[model samples]
Target: MDKVEVVVAHAERATLRVGDVFLKVDADRTRLDAEVEAMSLAPVPTPRILWRKPTVLALAALAGTTLGRLGGPSTGSPAAWAAAGAAMRKLHDAPLPPRQGRAGRSVVALTAELDAECEALVTNGVLPADLVTRNRRVAEAALRPWTPAFTHGDLQIAHVFLDGDEVTGVIDWSEAGQGDALYDLATFTLGHEEHLDDVLAGYGADIDRDVIQAWWSLRSLLAVRWLAEHGFDPFAPGCEVDVLRSRM
Candidate 1:
């Protein structure tokens, strides 16, 4: 596939070109014609960057706090972690149908996609065949009592920003759709488990720990599948199917 540079760089369906006057998107996914032209002068100049002063400062503070805590490259303070938990609680507990209750989902389809991905990785000498089967079984088990909730979908540290001891913003809204809160929690924990105690404390007692762990397992493996197939080396130490399978 002759991958388009802009498409590859940006995951979103739409984006503004370097010197273009209009926004472009996958025509199948979005109607480019429906979008209006920029309200700029002749050359259409680049889209004005939104001056998120507070947000930027918060992001800087978070970077400092996280780095201080990790003794290395980090994102932000425990404030961002707290904010993420609050955002999650609000999202999961929201009254909206897409976020509130369960959505119709097929375990079979999930399993098949997982298995196919595992098979692909194994074929490319990146995953073990036995571990792939084990992963399939674990995914099936986890799906048995699936309870979906509003999820951050991509709750990595980069999405977190801090202002003093509080979180100011969480950018990247592309994957904001509802799914499983646990899944989001797991991603948060896997990458930033150090703040779990604080995050959970703020989240309160109604949160389901078991469901969160199950979600953590399922979502991580699902993440592994994409990483493996797309040629992204697993970031977790010891990039092996067994490690991901264990999570499952």
Candidate 2:
């Protein structure tokens, strides 16, 4: 029998893998529901849902490996990266989902949330005041209005799978819905800036480079505290902290 592998676990939820199957266990049924709904709505390739219970959703594994991971080097060629970007563009062009996703927060709401999180960062000494302030200023550009699209709310590099230059599947749909398309681009290339050009090449749009960079800073600033509290090391090399310092 294949051993049960723990994919990821935190306060909110956990995922376990048993050979060909993956089990997502979330206490929040709504989140699980949202994930199921988004997977159904997404036009891009997504995992096959084998079954679902109230607290757990079973999924069949995809054939290809992920594009890469945060804080890690990507072995994917430029073509593979570009393929992922093209897939993203296809999803973005699809009809918007019914609900606003994580990337869909209003400017005022996002500003307030980032402000509070920034205060906590400085107050708690999680990040230097200057680092926080500089990034905050840069983050302001992302607070402007954006046309919403169907986004894979958490389009982390790890979520995109590729078989050579073709995209195989995208996993993790809990945060998917209508949101800023730039935010999705920003999140996919957060720690992997070198691949942004390649991704945008395949996305085939007149993207605003500055706005994507702004989202990088804002997203990093917002993630540091939460990641730290959740047993994740945002300060790790090539991670969120490093992304912020690069803006300096």
Candidate 3:
């Protein structure tokens, strides 16, 4: 029998791997259903649904390694990064899903959430006020209006898989929906600024650099407290804290 490996576990959900199958268990069925629906709607490659029962959904693993991790070095070549960008562009150009995604929240609502989270971070002493304030200023650029695209709400580097320079698969689709396209770009390039040019090359458009950078600040600032509370190290070398520091 294959040994079960825990992929990710938190209060909200968990994923377990048994051989080539990944079992996603979630308390929120809506999220899981959305994930299934999004994967079906996405133009990019996704894991095959092996089975599903109640809170657990089984998926056949994809056939490639990831692009990289947040605090680690990227093992993928520039071509691979570009391929990821191209894949993302395709996803963004696809038909909008039925439901709005995480990044699709109204600017007013997002602002209120960000403000509340910022206060909690400062009040809790999770981060220095100056850092928070500075990043908040930087984050303001992303608060304006945007044309909605079919966005993968969480397109972090690790979620993209590559076989050499070919993008084989993209995973974790619960947050996928119509949203600001720039958010996906920023999320992918966060903490890995060196590959921005490579990604932009395959993205094949003249996007606003400022908006992408603004998303980086907003994403890092909003992610810090949740990450810390969730048993993650936001201050790790080359992680979210370092990304914030680089902006100063």
Candidate 4:
């Protein structure tokens, strides 16, 4: 939305939406060869050799500046942090829609999937199997008291949008689903630790520590697998492989 405003105000502004970028897995030699053998000539998403790239790059740079001003650790001023904290608290407290009640998903089932993905990562040399298993067990213990609520599956800094000191919008709805609310909060805290305590505190008894930690660990582990499966790239824009690596 903010980008739309900037473009409208300018004499002319180029723009490139995220769908233009190909998923890393899709672009790999193996996948391309598979496509050729299948003899499918379906159109594939590709970067446009036009002003779109430059426009997207400019927008990204501006978005980074906004994030730094609002969420970065460098401000070092209590008032700024407090204001940002208040905004985050408001977001956490907002009334979310009821969970969609999807079938074939449960705490145990999801946890098992997370475990298998962790094992895959270890096999690929990105993580240690033993350590991941230990963490997986800890997460399972935490899920014992699980309760479902609306969750934004991807709530990192990249998914949040701010206008001045206020949150303007949130992007990426692919992972949104019914789950422990703490999962959403944990994802929110990944890169923006400065806002964690205040935001979670605002959530009150809606979620608890164990659930939050479990979500954090599981989400981090899932992130690693996602990168590996997608050939160390995000299917969507905004999140990069390095960010997922840091979480792992």
lDDT leaderboard ranking: 2, 3, 1, 4
> lDDT for model 4, on a 0 to 1 scale?
0.45
Candidate 1 lDDT, tens digit per residue, 1-248?
33323312233244433322223443333121111111111121122333222112111111222212211244545655666566557656654333221222456766676666767767876656676556555555446555665444566554445556555444333344446566666555653455776677656646666555555445555666566555545644533333455554
Query: Please, what are the lDDT tens digits per residue for candidate 3 over residues 80-182?
Result: 8899989989999898899899889899999998899889989999888998899889899999999899998999998998899998889899898889999
Clash-forming residue pairs, model 3: none
Q: Which stretch of 10 consecutive residues in model 3 shows the poorest summed lDDT?
A: 73-82
lDDT of each: 0.47, 0.94, 0.92, 0.45
Instruction: Return the number of clashes found in candidate 2.
Output: 0
Off by over 4 Å in 1: 1-80, 97-105, 130-141, 146-148, 206-210, 228-231, 235-248
lDDT of 2 by residue, 39-158 (tens): 999888899999999999999999889877999987789999999999999999999999899999999999999999999999998899999999999999999989999998899999
If scored against the real structure, what TM-score would every candidate get?
0.59, 0.99, 0.98, 0.55
Model 3 quality (TM-score): 0.98
Task: Please give, for residues 1-248, the per-residue lDDT of candidate 4 as tens digits.
Answer: 22222211212222234432222122134323322321121121112222222123221222211244212343223333343444444433444434332211576777677768877878887766665776676567445544555444555555554555444444333344445555656666654555556555544444466656665566666775555453444323323222333334
Q: Candidate 1 has what TM-score?
A: 0.59
Candidate 3 error regions (>4 Å): none
